[model samples]
Target: MKLKKLSAQCLLALGSLLALGAAQAQERVTAAIPGVVNAGTPIEFIQDGFKGTEGPIAAPDGAVLFTENNNARIIRIAPDNTTSVFLDNTNGANALAYSPEGELVAVQTIEPRVGVILPQGNARTLAVKVDDSLGFGRPNDLVVDKKGFVYFTDSGANGAVKPDPTKTAAPAVYRISPEYVIERIAKDITRPNGITLSPDEKTLYVANTAGEHIYAFDIDAKGKVGPRREFAHLEGLRQTENGPSSGADGLVVDAEGRLYVASNTGIQVFSAKGEPLGTIALPKQPQNLAFGGPGKKYLYVVGRGAVYRIPTLTAGYAGRAK
Candidate 1:
C-alpha cells in the first residue's frame, strides 16, 4: 500500500511538471539522473580549512553562511570567494535556515539551545528546554517549514552514538511552531540527524544516522506529523570507527523533489519515490549542503573543514527565501 501511494504520487509529480511545461520542469536536466543533480558538472573548490563546516546556507545577497562547528562561529563566503567571520560565539550553529521574515534560525547545540540570529548578529535563545521538559538530548539538525515552524532531531542516546540495548528510546523529531510552542511529533528514529520537507510541503524527511535509513512523514496544515515510513537507505557504507554502519547525516530536497543525502561516501541523490538516482562524491564526506545562486542554480557543499560549489539545473525548495 505504501509503495502504491508513493508510485501514484511520483507520477502525479511528473504530471505536475508536464502541466508546468517541460521548459519550467527543466527537461534538459533529465540528461543527468531522472531527478537528481546535473551530471558531469565539475565541482569547484571555493574555500577550505574551516572548523568542520556545516549549514552552508546562502544569504540573500548571494553570499553563503556556514557554521564552523569546532570554532563556534558562522563564516561567510562572499560572491568574490573571499571568506570572513560573520558571527562569533554561535553557541554551535550546526544547521541553519532563514525565516520568511528574514531571521536566521539555528540549531545551536553547544549550549543546547534553538535560537535566532538577531539583526545585529547576536544570538537569542528561543527554546532551551521546550517549556521545562527533559531538555534537548542533542539537537543535531533542523529545518524551518514555510510557515516559520522549525522541525529538528534530538537523538536520545548520545555518548559515542553507538547502538546499545540499554538505550531506552529512539531519537525524535520536535516541532517548534511559529508561536514558539514546542511539541514532539515522532520518536522512533534511532539517532535522527538531518531533516527537510518535501518540495510540495506535504511531507517531511528525516535522516536516521544510527538506523542508516531515511524516513518520511505526512505533514498537516498545523505542522503536525502523521505516520512515519521508510523513504531511503544509506547504501555501501562500511563499518565506522565505532563499530557501526555509516549513516545519513544531513539532507535537502530539490524543487524537483530529489532528496540529497549526506553520508560517509558523499551526497546520495534519490528520486521522489525512494529510488536510487546517483551520487556526487566529494573530497571528503560532506556534512551538509544548500542550494543558492540566482534562481537557486548552485549547490554549496560543506564538510571536513572545506566548502565546494557546483552548478545545478534544478532550483532548491525554499532555498531562496530571505
Candidate 2:
C-alpha cells in the first residue's frame, strides 16, 4: 500500500511540473501591445534547420515567403504550415518585396544588384552600379513604392572587408526610378539593414543594426526625402566588441499604420508616430517578420535558422507585402 501511495505522489508531482512548464511557455508569448497581440497567445514553432533566414514577406495568396540566403533560395510557407521552394538560384538574395506589377523584387548580394528575380525566365536587372563608375557596397534590403520606385540600402563593407576607394561605394540608400535612373537618397546612416514605407507611402523607415535608433524620412510626392530623423529608440541594445548593435533587421507596417521592428529583444511595436507600444518576445531573436495566413492575421517571424508564427489581433498593411 505504501509503494502504491509513493508512486501516486510521484505521478502527481510530474503532472504539476508539466503544467508549470506549459504555463511558463505561454507567458513568454506576451501581448504587451493590447490590440496588436492578445495576451496568452502562443507562438508556434513552424520549422527549423534553415541555412540562414531573413526578409519574410507575405504573398498575395496568404502565404509567407522568406529567403534562406546561405542556401541561395526562397522558401514559401503556406497557410496550412507546409513549406516549399518558391525560387532557387537567388544569387544570395536577402530581402524581398513585390512590385506594383506583382513581380518579385529582391536585393541580390552575390553580384550585389537589385532587380526582379521572378516570373523566372524574364528576370532583369533594375540597378547595379551606384554611380557611373563605382558598384554597390553589398545591397542589403529593398522596398518598392507604388510608383515602381525601388528603394534599397547598401550596407557597405563589414568586418575584415575594407572598402576600396576605387571600386566599392560607401553605405547609402538608393532609389531606382521607373525609368531606371539610379539616385542615391541617403548616405549618412551608419549601417542601414531593413527598409520599409508607411501605410500612406509618405514616410520611410530604415533600421540601423549598428545603432539604437530607427530612422525615419519624410517623402514628398516626387519621392524626394526631406531629412533623416531619429524616429524611435529601440530596446535591448547592447555594446559589442565591434560596436553597439541593436540587431534591428526588418521593418513592417500594419494596416493601422503601426510599425513593427525585428530587433535583438524581439519584435518591437511602435505607433504610427513612433511611440513605443510594447514588445513581443520570441524563442529566438527575430531577424525579419511578415503578416500572412488567413486574413493576414498571422505574424510569421524568421531568425536563427528557425521560423515561428503567432496569431495577431491585427492584419498587415494590404497596400504592400513586406
Candidate 3:
C-alpha cells in the first residue's frame, strides 16, 4: 500500500490519518432520490481462515475471486454458493483483475511481483523485480482494461527478508501494456491501494488509502494514463471492530456510473461527478467489492474474514451478460 503525504490542512479534512485507524462520521446524509434504501441484503459467509482478504473481483463466468493475503492464496466463491481455492502459493497476492482474454492478473505484494494465474491454478511470474528500469515498490492492487494491459500498484509488504528502507520506488502506480512495456504513471500517491476502471472503461480510479483520497486518470486509447487528478478525498478514515483497522481498500463501479468504495466506513457510493450520495452499511470493514448474481445487481463485499453481499438498483459495470 502507498503511504499518504499530507500537509496539516489535508489532515483537517480526513479528521485523522492512520494506516489502520478507525473512522468517525462527520455527519450522515440521506440517499438521493430514486435510490433504494434496501437494495442490498447480506449473503453467505465464505470463511476460509484468511487473516485478511483484500481484493475481490467478479470473474466473467460469474464466480467471485478474492485474495487471501495472509494465507497466500486466491479463493473463489461460485455463483452456486460453493467455495474453493483458486490458487495457492500466490505469495502475498493483494488485488486481482481479469484481462480481455480472461487471464487472471494479480499484484503480488511479496517481492513486488506481477503474476498471471492459469485457469488450472498454476501461477507464473509475468513481471518480477527485474531491475532499475521498472516501477513497482510493492504491488498491492490492480485492474485490467478491455485490452490485455495491466495497471497495478506496488506496496512491498511480504515475508521477504530483504530490507531496503530507502527504497526510492516510493509507492507509485504503473501500467504494463499489452506488449509488456512498463511505465510509471504516478508517484505522489500517499499509499495507493484499490483500483478500478469506469463502466465505459474510459477512465481509471486509484484509491490512495492513507491519504484518504481517490485519484482519477484519463485513459487514452493506448491504455496509458494521463496526468493524475484528484477524484474524491475522505480526509479522515479510521478503523472499527468490523474490519480494516483504517484506510480505504478496494473499489467497484456500477452501471449508472456511480463508484462504490470499500473502506473503514463500509461501502461509500459516489456519483460520477464525485458527490457523496449514499452508503451500504456493512458488519465489517470491506476490503473489496464486486457486482454479481443473476442480474448483476448484487454487490459482493469481501471483508473481515467473510464475504457478504447486498443488492443494487443498477447493474454491475463489469458483469453484464451478453
Model 1 lDDT per residue over 127-201, tens place? 767544556656778887677888888766463333332433346788888788888778766678888888777
lDDT tens per residue, model 2, 1-322: 9999999999999999998886565345676577798787888878878998988988888788999998889999988898999988998898999999999999987777898998888789998887766887678888998889898998886622344657888889888988999888888888998899998999999999989999999998866788899999999989988678899988888889899999999999999989999999998889988888887788899999989898888898887886
My TM-score estimates for the predictions, one after another, are 0.81, 0.89, 0.78
Candidates in order have lDDT scores of 0.75, 0.87, 0.70
TM-score of 3: 0.78
- Which digits, one per residue and each the tens of the lDDT, describe model 3 over residues 1-322? 1235456557766665642243222122223324533433333444534677777877777777888887889888888768888888877788887777766777876556787866646556777743464435668788877667687876544335343645536677778878777777787876778887787777888887766567899987765568888787663366545333337778888878888888767788888877777666665667888777766777777887877766566778743211
Which one wins on TM-score? Answer: 2
Residue pairs with backbone overlap in model 1: none
Better of 2 and 3 by TM-score: 2
Give the range where candidate 2 is weakest over 10 consecutive residues by summed lDDT.
157-166
Candidate 2 accuracy as lDDT: 0.87
Deviating ranges (above 4 Å) for candidate 2: 1-28, 159-166, 241-243
Worst window of 10 by summed lDDT in candidate 3: 19-28
